[model samples]
Target chain A: MTRDRIGALFFLAVSIAYGLMSLDIRVPPFASEGFTARSLPLALSAAGTLIAFLMLVLPQKDGPGVEPAGRFLAGLGGFDWPRIAGLALNMLAYGFLLTRVGFLVSTILFLIVGYRLLGERRWHVLLLASVPVVVVFWAILTQLLDIFLGSALGRWGQLLAAQFSGGA
Target chain B: MLDGILTGLSTALTPTNLAMVFIGCFAGTFIGMLPGLGPISAIALMIPITYGFDPATGMILMAGVYYGAIFGGSTSSILINAPGVAGTVATSFDGYPMARKGLAGKALAIAAYASFSGGTIAAIFLLIAAPALASVALSFQSPDYFALMVLGLTAVSAFAGRGNFLKAMMMTVVGLMLAMIGSDPVVGMPRLNFGRVDLLDGISFLLLAMATFALSEALMTVLKREKISDAARAATQGRMGSLKLSGAEVKEMAPVVARSSVLGFFIGVLPGAGATIASFLAYGMERNFARGAKKEEFGKGSIRGLAAPETANNAAASGSFVPLLTLGIPGSGTTAVMLGALISYGVDPGPTLFTERPEVFWSVILSMYFGNVILLILNLPLIPYIARLLTLPSNLLVPLVLFFSLIGVYLVSFNNFDIYMMVIVAVVAVMLRLFDYPMAPMILGFILGDLMERNLRRSITLNDGSISFLWERPITLTILVITAVIVALPLVGFFRQRRRLAQAGEGG
Candidate 1:
């Protein structure tokens, strides 16, 4: 019921779920059993879970007697609706525009919206600042040479080629 | 040993290799100097650009960024009392004190020099130790690996814990559990997909890191509503003039440097034991060792105090790599990012890498030494200049970090879906940070989740549901014993303390 304990619980749940999920990881037949890709993390996570469970059982009982700190954390809980909504919208925006608008454009727009949401607010500022950034990033990573930023150029190649042909 | 040094120097002195080290170190320091910035973020941000380099060159850049970031974390701490990341918190203890005493010049010198001592000494240690460790471990079986991980987890709890040792354990355990959500290692069945393709990969460790460390920190700052930039500026008020160490200061620092280097390197060798502990432990050890008139300098601005932790942590930073390069096991969050970087380059870090790929091994080793020198030189003059960057407004710094992180994260997949994921995770990360939940274990969890599950499946399949399987292996038994000791001892101690506290409270 400790807030910090609850915090540990939240992460602990994630560990259990993660460990449980490892049962299904696909490994190439060629991969070795002892030190294969999955083996290292699988062992590591189990240890992580063990460590977390111990945290719950042990008590330092520091400072003044503990009191419920927050409604949600203290178990007087309700959904974190605002955060859930914000996250949902953010995902929706990215999913919708990923291929439709292209990597650079969609990425810039995403960064701007996220910045604005965090209170960046000024469109002129966001545009002036964010655009050059994406361009410089584009120039440094893509134009100069291929650097992996997920695949904006690859996806847009057909559209870009079609335009080039049209212009020629 | 001498031949190794000469060979290392010969390869390191080449124009491209030298330049790469310089670039890596310079980049590392740049990110390190910027408060709230770290190597992982630097790597994630620059991953897009490095993708084009020769794998070794790319690794050099990443290696530079890694060490540089560790070295950089102290700048903000000394320059403004704000720790750039979790690793530098110990550095700030005495660093800020020395700065306030007008001995900032001395403090900067100690940090630069101590960083050098730690980095170079540990690099040497790595050169000597890595080969030995790898050669010995070349024949490990799956059961053995499971045992090793248990050993590493125990070591990690020892290092990552402070006020809440049990909680740290809890955090570690939870981190491990979450890492297990993806496809089963044995048969490839997805356990937590909830029917989403993305879920098949489970949650990405990198995504989790950005969400928890970078994004969460960003959100909490907003919630606090105080302008950190202004406060930071006011706090870091100083000139970065020529940083030099006085003869007396140098003399005092020499022994501290030697001691911390030894201490830092050993601790860093343990997987999951990060620089944070190396520094804190060094600080405690220095205080204990200071028995003379010099003892008074422990907390109130001792250059020795500052030198020890910086050297120790940097050494520890180097030590963390031993496991990574030798065994392919990342010892800390930053190293985890490095592991991801290696993967992106399609390079696996394990015993065979040494024999099969000497260039990758040696070149990276050679680059690290030069990187340390470059960091020292860069940080020496640049500290004051970069200290000014400490004044960035909260609104600006916050936005910039988030922007770059998102860009960095998005570039990871160009899947705006990832960006969206970043934002959502960031918000959750923010909540977690606000509540004082340590983010390191979560990052540790996410990073290790996939592998934990895989090994479990493989082991169970190999053992065929025999409950005695884990206990049967000698290595496994030993590790389990250690884990049992580590886990049990701490829980008992914590409970005793709680009872004592409760009784004392009633008496009072």
Candidate 2:
């Protein structure tokens, strides 16, 4: 399918899912005299569904020409899918590692991996670039802003301490 | 009016506010000179840092960044023929030719002076017009406000690049859906949380903005492999010749600058007609107005050609603030981001803002004057140093951008879940962007969605739940009619095109 078709179908699915979920919104009895919580969501989802349906039927006038279904399926291999996929995975891993390790450790690791994925070759350049960025951000956010950078080991250590104190 | 001006000057002249203005202008210019980052991203990246400041100070900083980015955009356009932002694309027409002729210094200097002139002129106009416009808006009711918000949302379709009206509208509705995720503002009941306790307070606007603008832009750069060429990088080096314009050149360009400034400011006042459109219109008008050899020199390094767009774009940048400050309607994407910032700072930008938060209103306006002066001084002597930023590799910049976004979002709530959500939002935004979907309407919808809903509900309740109340009020009716016409015009054109294509098929 073409990009427009894919987009339309994707939005169509989302609208239906969100519409169904909106049906479960609970309104309070003593609420103000006006539209309830579910009203806007239902209206938005319905409008979205209508627009998405129109998009499916309307012919695309711009961008790359539409090709056969087989070509469309094969087109996946035409672009740099691996790089995109690697970056996405890198972001997910960074998020997971952020809480597991700490801000500084996770940020440096994420940047190094991201640099390699983007075709950076020199290890020194990667370390030199990523480490300073991590340190600067850490200093600004933690010291200046006073936000805590949580770590998995810190949480685990707290849990172990709580268990020992309870046993004692 | 004079009292407000004095109050604004006093507020903007404070040590901290002056420092904020200088920093915001410097950072805006530096970032705007970099490829792939525009004024919108510049503002979005700086938003997290402004959370610790007062509302007036934050507004001043953002206002500085807003116009400062426009000034910086022209540097890349003149030097490398690659516009740093969309608004400066027209600047490259004659600017690059002048650079090839080794008049790069003159071209950069002219652009800086023209921008300063336009910005200062538009600041004067803003001072005169905003208060009057705010007074008019002060009498507005809930229904009128509702109509105005709808009009603002619909007007974005005009700027939605190419023929993606439906796609833009779809993105807008999706934004509205996203805005509904937290507890209902009206009833205090949680909805769309999906049973997550972290979502009860709703998704943070900071996270959404960082994801949509900054993080998504970084990911797209990686996916598309956007890079500045080595040749273009080298072009930015070397001794910049005389930075001074001859007396005659300045005298000749003065009228063009004045004319384009006025034209650009009016265009900027209209919703959805932003700096890009204003610059193009000004450039075209100047070309038509030029006579003799000047007309032939348009694309061949004409000073009038270069100055017209530079002036108009900066003027338009200042003019776009009129609707945002007075009527609570953002005329462009950058202003929409600023609108979100304004709301986040608990400084609602509407007619009442002039009366309620006079300091915020006046200080921001006054700071634009200082910002333009700062940009001129920074751009003239330091063009070479500033141009070096364009050489920074995308590979290094991309990771650093992602790092800032991650830390910015994480710092907001100190919740890892928000970071995860930011990544998700960024992924979704990138996917939509690949399909030519415009991101501006979605943001506009997201920012105004809650207000739109509340006003709508309140209006209906005033009329005892009668929907006809919308059509009964004259202001609401007129605004809605205008909105309908704007929305329907594109659909009408689409159908006409379809019919013509069908006829052509039959003939073929």
Candidate 3:
């Protein structure tokens, strides 16, 4: 299938599955609360399936002429999957090591590597970017806001604290 | 108007607010000067810092950053041939060419004035229109609201997809489907959750937005070879010259500004259309309205040439807030990002803001004035100096942007996970931009995805499983009509062009 076709199909399949999922939901005041969760998916499925059918079946009598449109449609299917695979893997890895590695190492390592992969230059630029990102983020999360910065590793931050507090 | 404006000026003049606006203006000017980094990033970066402020003050600071960044984005486009934002790309044509012609001073002056003219005009439009739109929405029933959301989603398909209507429609449908991830809202049950706690809340819209816009842009940059050429470096001399508008120039551009403001504001107020379309439309309007021979002045550095899109884009940015603030409907991704900002601040934009939180409503309007004045002052004289930024190497510039983006995302939710998420997404975003996939629809998808799914379900459920209710409502019908008109527009364009071709053939 073409990318548009594949996108249409993938979306359609999920919509149907979600509709089934919503139908299986349990809720309050409906004879049985069991089916409440399934409603959203059901609705989404209907819309999804309908849209996918249109995408798949409809000829789109009007397009940007036949040749370019065909190439455009076909090309969309050929996303640079290897690069995307790297991006997805980077995210998955970061998500798992989030608390264990601390924000600094994980964020910079990923961003610097990602930047290099995406065609940035200079070793100095990469190294410099990592430090401020860590410190600025640490300040924003721990010192400033109530966002979900995990301090489960807080006590160990004594090393960082000691650095700031003159070796305590 | 003076009383209100002066009162707002005074409110903005407080020491802390003044400092904040100054800080915001400086940061906004630079960030905005960079094409892709924008007000949402500015606001997201500051959200952590503003945690200590009073709510109104916090909001004012954020607004300063937001408006400042938008005005700043116009600067780089005019001088460096880089549009700091997607919306500013149209500005680059006349803007850069004007600089190349050694009219950097004149161009900067005109752009600053145009920014204020459009900004003030649209601010006034927002002041007038938002309340009116809100009051209309106040009378809407649950059925009306459900329909409104659908209309907004349909708008995504209409605006984003121009030549390829079905492809745009397909994208919108996919977006709506992506929104269905996570637990069901009404039943409090996990539909797509698959027993994982992480999936319960669904994908973060910010993450998706990062992936699509920021990440995709970064990805696209990799494939494209650009030497960030600031050709105006030699042209723009030491200090910027006067800000005074010449009488002859003013007389010539007066009508252009007036027409563009109206055209831009109307398009901006629409749910899906953006500054790009509005700017293009305003320029077209100007072309149509131009004197018989002056049409050639366009694309050749005419003052009116520069003014049309500048006025329209800024006006569109401000006007886009009408649906967002009044009716809780966002017109485009930037506004959608603004919606996320509002949510992050615990401020739900709806009738309640008008009824109970008038301060939030009026103060935001008030802040736009302050932000605009700050941007005008900061941008004009600083244009020559700020133009130096273009000479900064991409090697240094790119990594810093990556750093800030990383820091910005992490501060939002200090989970190292969010940071990692940003880095990974930024990479992908960079790649996508390398190719030709439009990033706007993806962010639009991520933002409105869940809302579309919820409303679609609600509309159907309220009607007891019949699709009839969707077509039964008059408002829905009106929306459907508008949608049909839009869907038919491309076909109309195609046939009209084809007819012109036939006429030429006959004449031959």
Q: Regarding lDDT, does 1 or 2 come out ahead?
A: 2
lDDT of 2 by residue, B369-452 (tens): 999998888657887887887788888888788877887777678777887788888888887886668787788788888888
Model 1 chain B: weakest 10-residue lDDT segment is: B448-457
Q: Pick the candidate with the highest lDDT.
A: 2
Fnat of model 3, as a fraction: 0.39
Better of 2 and 3 by lDDT: 2
What C-alpha RMSD separates each model from the true structure?
A: 5.2, 3.0, 5.2
lDDT, model 3, position B203: 63
The interface root-mean-square deviations, each candidate in sequence, come to 6.3, 1.9, 5.1
lDDT measured at residue B205 in model 2 versus the true structure, 0 to 100: 74
User: Could you tell me how far off, in angstroms, the CA of residue B271 lies in candidate 1 after the best superposition?
Assistant: 2.7
The list of candidate 3 runs beyond 4 A from truth reads: A1-36, A56-98, A104-133, A136-168, B1-14, B38-59, B229-245, B412-437, B449-508
TM-score of chain A of 3: 0.63
Q: Score the docking of each candidate (DockQ).
A: 0.27, 0.61, 0.31
User: What lDDT does candidate 2 reach at residue B418?
Assistant: 82
